[model samples]
Target: MATPDALAFRFFSLQVVRTESLGPSLVRVTFAGDDLAHFHSDGRDQSLSLFLPAEGRSKPAVPFEEGENWYQAWRELPDDVRAVMRSYTLRALRRDPDEIDIDFVLHGVEPGAAVAAGPASRWAADAKPGAEVVLIGPAVADNRAIRFRPAEGTDLVLMWGDETALPALLASLESLPAGLPVRAWVEVPHAGDVQDVVTAADAEVTWLVRDESSAEGAFPALDAIRAAGLPSARKPYVWLAGEAGRMKELRRHFVGERGVDRRQVTFVGYWRRGLTEEQLREQPQE
Candidate 1:
């Protein structure tokens, strides 16, 4: 098959206009720029890189470059080098001359959470109006082209994720076929961590608490899902995302044991356990 245009993965720059708390653990930052008019809306999960200044410092601005070396400079950056580049999802897009809003989930004081949280959180916490930040790639669309064509009609769609995957999950939910039924299975560490999600689709949402399960291999939430079983043998589409190892296990259970058609599933490794933000992109996906 012919490949999609290279522009599909392109990015642009924007300045933060404001920030607000989504919950105790999430930050919503709104940005706008003339370049956003060119933002691509390919209906796939998109990612971006935000550069943040080191702690105990004023915001720093990097001049945007229209060349490849800019990205190289970012990648080759060494630690102990104050500046940082963090990766995050583009949760929503607006195209009235290029303005977009992105949400960054905060890490609190946890070190592991910091790897999943990025410059977006850093900026959201401390950035001020007029602060400039460059938005990186929408990062090449998923290899699998998704079509919402009503082939094997179904009564519902099942969606699940942890805090790490919430942004993408939220975006995906908004794009589902209008009136299609959906069931959301979300697992968050704390009760206050949950935030209201805005989606037009018909959905039955459920939240899971981590303490209810064992230390490992003991997910009562997942078990609940397994017990509930697939929506139907007609095969409802399933979406799974979160930490790399956890997502892999869920994928195996869903595909290996349940025998769901591979084409009807969208499983993603949003991050890996113990990997720093910079190390996350290097972890390969299956």
Candidate 2:
């Protein structure tokens, strides 16, 4: 059940091209790879599952070894044995035949925490001129199936998300229809989390802060949105993501109560308040 080297079109060894702090909590590590020329450009905003080895391992334990298959290994792996792999989004990808760049967000606490934690974080921390790490997934172009196309005569685009969805939000805005008015609502843990965002459309941004509590708990920003009402009478195309429950509330307020076209709204529950990524994966779709 191991992914074969012949099937390795999905695999790559990307070097850390550079690193930058986009905001207080977000770290962007640009990756360059030889195989990047083959990456599909449509994969932007799609989640990528990365398998990282321990600090000193020469070669990663690929899913299935000669003696055991990947699925059997997965079934028998100890709790600690499997925590090394993490899934993250393909925030952005720029492909040149000789190289490519992929951005990753950091999460955790330590000195220079954003730069020193998580697999990608640690990789970027120790990464040097020629350091390399494996990458596997469709390129931005191939991953664009999840992408939403603007409807004809659309006047506005509305987007909402928390930190988990920033990569997607940023990528989406970058590709939004030019000349359309756009409004985006984003929630983050603190005011320091705000980052300069660039977009192709006419833009208005509202940053929702959650210092004493999680962004999903009685969020004042969402309440404010409810009170202000949607700005366009024609109604904007809405896209929302973040905590599952909070997104549900917003969806109800928009499509249920506000009478927005159901097809015009897209909502994604990127995470749950108290669940681990694994737990969130097990959740039944509502």
Candidate 3:
């Protein structure tokens, strides 16, 4: 790990510095380490591969000795020993002390939750100070992991996301140029899950709580966005993510019905209904 490749992604060993309950369904975990001196990111929707320690293990079982081949090496380990890897976005980054915050959605961890708790969710729910984890993140300030690319001439921005995409959406909003027009929508399971956002962008954000009327697979936000009509912009960038099935519907509505340029739309399926991250990874990417 002495040299960073052209891609600029490298492994960093970090430990939990603190954890805070953001809401009923969200938890914020802050991590720091000496290795963080090398970590850098430009922020908007930056993706990171987090490796949590396997159950009963002290630290994540990452094969750092294998260098760039760490992914394959770690995968070859026994299921019980291998670290649990999950994708997450950087909620915030600070330099003075070199710390990063990641927001995790705690599904099924709440009292009498309907859904089941996944490993990552459970890890986040009970995370404590000094818990060690490994991260595969950008070493360079700007890398390919960021997806919120607003075209130069864009006059307005359109964004949509569910709880899973909340961190990315908020980070993107915070990074946008001041006074930029932004129309954003967020869907969360509980009203208590709503977060107060701080962004310089001239943004109008709406939170939609999922209920019986609006089922999991239903793209209810699409209808609301469609009814509001597109903001007046010659060139507007659309970024929508979370819940594969619903995200697809939003993309279709923007690109097809409203005629937003497909290229200008950055749509990502952060996760899908009833599918674990591992299962989602198995599906072919668009």
Q: Tens digits of per-residue lDDT for model 1 on 1-286?
A: 2236544555466678888767666768888877776665554356566666655545433334425455566455454444566766767776654667777766653465534444546557776777766665543444223222223676667777888777777777777666777888888777887767677778777888678346766766668777764445466677887877776677777778777676777777767767776687666645
User: Per-residue lDDT for 1-286 in model 3, tens only?
Assistant: 2554546888899999999988888999999999999998999999999999898888899998887677799889999899999999999989899999999999888677677798999999999999999999998978888999998999999999999999999999998889999999999988999999899989999999878565545666877898885568999899998988888888888899888999999988889877889999999999
| RMSD over all Cα atoms, model 2 | 4.6
TM-score for each model: 0.79, 0.78, 0.95
Q: Please count the clashing residue pairs in each candidate, in the order shown.
A: 2, 14, 0
Which residue runs of candidate 1 sit more than 4 Å off their true CA positions?
1-4, 42-44, 54-66, 77-83, 95-98, 110-120, 138-155, 212-217
Worst 10 residues of 1 by lDDT: 142-151
List the candidates ranked by TM-score, beginning with the highest.
3, 1, 2
Best by lDDT: 3
Candidate 2 clash figure, as a count: 14
Q: How good is model 1 by TM-score?
A: 0.79
Please, what are the lDDT tens digits per residue for candidate 2 over residues 1-286? 5345334336566666767766666667677766777666554356565665555653344454423345467546664444245566667766443544445445564464443355655654455555556655664443333655557777878778888787878777887656778878988876777877787788888888766544435677667777764566585688888778888888888888778797888887877877766677778887
Q: After superposition, how far is residue 198 of candidate 1 from its true place, in Å?
A: 3.7
Question: Model-by-model lDDT, in order?
Answer: 0.66, 0.66, 0.90
Specify the highest-TM-score model's number. Answer: 3
